[model samples]
Target chain A: MRVLGVDPGLTRCGVGVVEGVAGRPLTMLGVGVVRTPADADIGHRLVAIERGLEEWLDTHRPELVAVERVFSQHNVRTVMGTAQASAVAMLCAARRGIPVALHTPSEVKAAVTGSGRADKAQVGAMVTRLLRLAAPPRPADAADALALAICHIWRAPAQNRLQRAVAAQHAQNAPKGRTA
Target chain B: MRVLGVDPGLTRCGVGVVEGVAGRPLTMLGVGVVRTPADADIGHRLVAIERGLEEWLDTHRPELVAVERVFSQHNVRTVMGTAQASAVAMLCAARRGIPVALHTPSEVKAAVTGSGRADKAQVGAMVTRLLRLAAPPRPADAADALALAICHIWRAPAQNRLQRAVAAQHAQNAPKGRTA
Candidate 1:
């Protein structure tokens, strides 16, 4: 699957495209950052983000996307922005019929560093080592984004997704289903 | 100063471009809505929003942006998306050397409807009437965005903005500057 990993932020969203064969090597397609100025108004900022992503999407054509699922508690304002950015990312993938996967910070950290509690620096270090790159991914955010994709790779089940869904539904509605 | 106002959201973000003339009308240059899928990941959703905004920005470049400062209770996920979308919008405008103006929801509402307690429907009605359009702006969210632009126009005095800033700073720092 060709996976695009994204670190969504209003001002700066990091994007990384990685393609992997079922049993072969995973290759890095491309990596870059979409940045917006601090003084731009909300409308313009969002537009800039769209434009940047469009440029990347045109070039990468990722078949799937992995984005970090936010569970942050920083405050209302901060959380609001994070969620909006996430929503925007999801929308882009959905419109293109590109399947999307979301990974928590802990999941990414664990996948990259073998520890769920790993910090950004540690995760970055591990990402660089695993990818065997010439340099560590700059702007910590970008590295985390790549790690998120790695986590999704490890987590995505091959053929049991539907089975789990039915099982969960059966468990939740067993009593109600009997009544109906 | 020309200003673009944005009402950021995942499903739809409202964008209104307005140009301020010294004594002429507040020219409504353009208005549109950027849409994203509701079920998409936040990252892809953001990409869609960016694409929509980019088209508008390329068509009409406003010099300043006015966005409603977000405030919400409950629904952390929703709030997070809004905030991130708002940030992206801000970055886009700022990158083009546009100054950003943030107005509180109450401030925008009061300026548009002369009442801080005005509901969304009331604000939408006033905006439709104020713009003197053939019909009410569809997708209340878009009208809400125009209202934000109108609010900025009404709140920003015609006098030199720089001088006003200095005087306002003085008033805050020097209590003696207050007339009362």
Candidate 2:
């Protein structure tokens, strides 16, 4: 499956497309950053990011979209922008009927580098090796996006199985006469 | 001018429309809440909000949209959801070319009740009195939404004048060879 990963931010949103399946080699389809000026109005910046994401969705046509799950930060302003950007990504995917997944930073690091505490350099090096690229993608965010996609590709199967198991257990435990 | 005020929340988004000019009696065009189930998927919840906001925009056709500016809250999850909802409200307004304004909760309270520290009851009472309603709107969020509209109606004139003055000063200071 192909996945478009988004490292959401207001000033610079990183996007990368990866095509692969579990237990198989992966290929990088595209990678870029959508940059909006810091001085731009918040609404306009969001609109720009929306348009950029739409373009990526249109051109890449990934089967699923992976977005970084925003966690609380000491910098409220930064966290707010990240959350807004992440919402835009989710909205874009929903509008297109494309499935979207969110991966935490630690989850992504663990998936890509086998260490939740992996440093940026280690994660970048692992991503480079995994994708067979000559060098790591620049601007840290781009590499992070790729890592997110890789994480989702590797984890989705296990997650889906767990979801199904829970659903089956719920069905078995429900009263026989329940309509739901 | 008509204004649509949005008190954005993930579980229950409060929306209200008011029509009036500065220094005049305002009319309440509409008031309601758009609610999404807490158990729904995040993407689906966002899409539901988008649809609800779009419907309000289409039905009310407000000239401006006033959204409560999301601030950092002690509850990170609540703040993130509020920020996301606020972004969706802004997106709806921007998509329709409607001017969007953000009012802080304190700003709304101050505009309506002459005290930024006013309690919800005070703000609701003022909204009822200002709109000539027999009673305050139910659900504090709905009342807050109306308060936001009233705040924008009252502040727009001074804000416009300040914007124009700033623009004029910039124009006057521009280089002679520059054309703007």
Which predicted model would earn the best DockQ?
A: 2
The DockQ-based CAPRI class assigned to model 1 is incorrect
**Interface RMSD (C-alpha) of each candidate?**
16.1, 10.0
Tens-digit lDDT track of model 2 for A42-146: 766777788889899889988778999998866889998999999988877765556678899999999998999999999889989999999999888899999
Q: In CAPRI terms, where does candidate 2 land?
A: acceptable
Consecutive 10-residue window with the lowest summed lDDT within model 1 chain A: A171-180
Instruction: Score chain A of model 2 by TM-score against the reference chain A.
Output: 0.87
Predicted candidate 1 versus true structure: per-residue lDDT over B1-180, tens digit per residue: 666789977788999877764445666777778887787545446656656765676677665567778776747666666776776566555444445678888898898789999998899888777776766676877888888888887787543275345434533643321011
Find the 10 residues in a row with the least total lDDT in model 1 chain B.
Answer: B171-180
Q: How does the DockQ of candidate 2 come out?
A: 0.26
Best by TM-score: 2
Give the per-residue lDDT of model 1 (tens digit) for A65-119: 7888876566655555556566556655554545667788888887768899988
Please state the error at residue A117 of candidate 2 in Å: 2.2
Interface DockQ per candidate: 0.16, 0.26
Model 2: lDDT to the true structure: 0.83
Q: For residues B1-180, what per-residue lDDT tens digits would candidate 2 score against the true structure?
A: 788999999999999999998988999999989898999667667877888888898899887789999988668889989999998888767654566789999999999999999999999999999999999998888999999999999988767456445434533653211010
* Candidate 1 segments whose C-alpha is farther than 4 A from its true place: A10-17, A21-61, A75-99, A113-115, A132-139, A157-180, B1-5, B12-65, B72-74, B84-101, B121-143, B157-180
